[model samples]
Target: MTTNNVRGHRRRLPAIVATVIATALTLTACGGGSDAASDDDAATAGAADDGSFPVTIEHAFGETTLEEVPERVVTLGWSTHDIVAALGVVPVGVPETWGGDDEGYSEWFRDQVEDEIGGALPEILNYDDSGELDFEQVLALAPDVIIAPVWGVDEVSYDRLSEIAPTVAHLDPENSWSSTWQDLTVMVGEVLGRSDAAGELVAQTETLLDDATQAHPEFAGASFVYGLTLSDGATELGLYIPDDPRVRLLRELGFVDTPAMQTVLDSVEGGNWYGGVSLEELDTVEADLFLAWSAGPEELAYTLEHPTFSRWAPIASGHYLFFEDEALAMATNGPSPLSIEWALANGFVDKLADALAGGAVTVS
Candidate 1:
């Protein structure tokens, strides 16, 4: 019988019956080896004999009744792969290139996975351009589950992947890249029968963030701006309105976005999901701290020197923060719980701390 049928049977029991049955089956499966077991064995010990099973997770794709801890899993998105790898699970497949071959994996991520897995990389699927699902390659792995918790893959892709095995989609629409590493570890923990371990991981990260935030309370009254400039230098600005996860994180660090950015948030139809601003209109952004992404350092340097650029408030104030293009791109498109932490650890937190400490890091 298919895995879905096994889970369906377990889903029918009363709350107590379900929980007891699931727990017993999970223990039995845990005792057994990691290999796939017989249908009757799985049906009795996996789900049917016990309703509670080890742990079940309900996600956007469908409910996953993880009867036995999944040994061979596949991650469809780059961030999902990072999440699994961070949890010490070497997913069977991961995207070969996230943005470009040159900027594939975030530096810290590559190091973590390689160090743990001894450089034995998974099947690298190409997600460089279109960011859609590659069904054929994924099915061949015969994964117990697929993790695709990013925005690139739409609902149609989610449905197709569900046919092959359990697939987890984005946690929510607005918080697309805002998922905390702690929550991701918990999700992987449930799938791998390591919830306790996941909880511990969350606790550790919480301590780290708390420490970072506490170290720089001066950020409490600080204001900042963030956005990106395209190939030709036209800006696509996004104000992190109060509810945005990134903005929430900044608030935790005691920083607020500039008042002008708040106005843009108020004026936009969709509250500035993305604002297209021409090079000539650079004067509008008014903030104590200016942050923006560019194709590379060369382009960023040119924009700073442009005569008309002098009017941009942050540019005039000498309080701009510039992040590596590749890193920022990954943060924008390939964001995962782990990657966000990597951002914090590598520069985001430290840079802000430096600014608050009255260091010599000038915007120009």
Candidate 2:
């Protein structure tokens, strides 16, 4: 059994710092306000004067105290931008979204910025394929604070970013991506002086998930295995652990993990979110339903026709769900208040219901 190890594989800070220094040398000194604020220009107008500031938040890289509500904010990592936007604070800089709209923004985020907030998009910071932050770009933004509660910010990166501005790293020092949506929202709210508002938002989103669970009684006690099948002709079947946000969301919807999933979890080391099982042993990981995401239609077609995958119980019995829409898949995999609402409105729950009805479904 081969394992796809993703833990502690991030590029060390010396290499990242060297790259940033090299990139900084070529860049001209431009004003930070060129594309920092939204069209409305009142970035902090929506922030409540709840006396939540002068707050110290403990994170993976020690503690950071915000003296006042952040006016010029910058967000790194997945979902931090979404959470900031959801809380009515327009960020000066945000990480570019992968599998998002053409402009490197999520559809829900774009709608919120353009239609709801009546603001222009923030500057999109570039990151490498390995999810390394562009330190030079972040430094150029001259932000008041850097929010990154769910990113892979190692000690060195955190210290460097702190030199630029007070930076918040992950909640757990050991696990880079362990913070749940609820924990992240509360932390963001505290930073923005909107603790009450954050609590309300959490409750509202949870209510939506609860409503779905109550509405779908069949999901109760059902077994499920969520994973991915590579289009690159890999010999292993990737599986997400229960702690993964996607699997946690499924569990919230009343699904339970299977013994096969437990086996995978038992084999996984700390800090890794996923594992893999050989295709030859696919039948051993049986469950009432199987779920996966495909890169596109061609990838889905390839998996369905693969000799070994074709014989898997879920595929043969038509009890499987596949996502062909990258945006929808991103919404579930990295959920936030804005994305969750957009997902439900755009048939995320319905797709699951259709799959649970005992037929293979490929959501487009």
Candidate 3:
């Protein structure tokens, strides 16, 4: 029974309806039907040609556009460079760190970005003690546009970053990493005049996700607990409430969460949020599949060795699952098109296969 303290870190979204309209426009941008009139039938294929119009977008951040291909684009926040690079637009600069240290970006993303775009790592722009973005350094980079999707930046940060260039923020707080990836890919595509490539990448990723999900039908009809434990031994259990992409993904696998987990899930109020319980109350989390995350190696060790923890029915029944930081992070935070396939290939597929096979292997 652990309280989900991490929910306190929930993203703050704009209350203004303007943000909603912006989101719709961004989706249209992603779908590849810009308002600009193009005479070339080839342009409708999501390509740029001699008749392509000058596209300028105004959003929550600010207004900016591309008369032609932008030379210097700056990507902000965590892991957006992957989408940009996937669309063949190498960012001139990106945040060296996502939050504080923590390797900031995923290994798969870093390798892919570096492989596609050869350049020095971008400057790290985050709070230095008092929680303030280094706007001066960002301004120095002089980027054509800024792509930020991971963290929920405040209005001030949004304004400042927008001043440098158009800054793309998360469309909705509840939306997962995959939504951010799709939105930013289109946003970057618009600026770089690579909408065709953007559409192709999105299509490709959709296909990959479809194939991966179809490969593991055993995951169907199972419910799971997706969450993390902090250094203080507190657990942040993902209730997998309705509308959450993870829950949606699980549903796609032909599985449903156990009634126990679903009970706690229904108890969540205000939003598709969570239920907080004490570590002593771990029994509340009831599911056929248990997936927990540790902040690091030490946390994981403590969880496995704890005498009281072994008494938990799930652990005792061998339904307990624990993931290292990497898998945990990827499962929750890495929601890109590539990420879905990566998650499947890396271990998710095998785990489902084993689960379906009724193997005695413990999920490590």
Per-residue lDDT tens digits of candidate 2, residues 226-301? 9986676789888999878889889988999977886787667668998888889888987888889887767777
In terms of lDDT, the poorest run of 10 residues in model 3 is: 1-10
Which candidate, 1 or 2, would have the higher TM-score against the true structure?
Answer: 2
Candidates arranged by lDDT, highest first: 2, 1, 3
lDDT of each: 0.54, 0.75, 0.52
Model 2 global lDDT (CA atoms, 0 to 1) = 0.75
- Could you give candidate 3's per-residue lDDT for residues 1-364 as a string of tens digits? 2111211121221121122224334554665544443232111112232334488754444455556544556766555665665553446566654222255655444444454333344445555778677788778767666766555365678877777876666545443233445566666566656665566666665565566667776566666665544344445333445455555555555667656665566566765445544456667666566556556667766765666665666556665455553543454454554445445545565554554443422333
Q: What is the lDDT for 48 in model 2?
A: 46
Give candidate 2 misplaced runs (Cα > 4 Å): 1-42, 128-131
Report the number of clashing residue pairs per model. 12, 0, 12
Q: What lDDT score is found at residue 349 in candidate 3?
A: 54
TM-score of 2: 0.85
Q: How much lDDT does candidate 3 score?
A: 0.52
Per-prediction TM-score to the true structure, in the order listed? 0.71, 0.85, 0.69
Candidate 3 segments whose C-alpha is farther than 4 A from its true place: 1-53, 56-68, 97-105, 117-126, 173-180, 230-285, 305-313, 325-328, 355-364
Model 1 residue 55 lDDT? 63
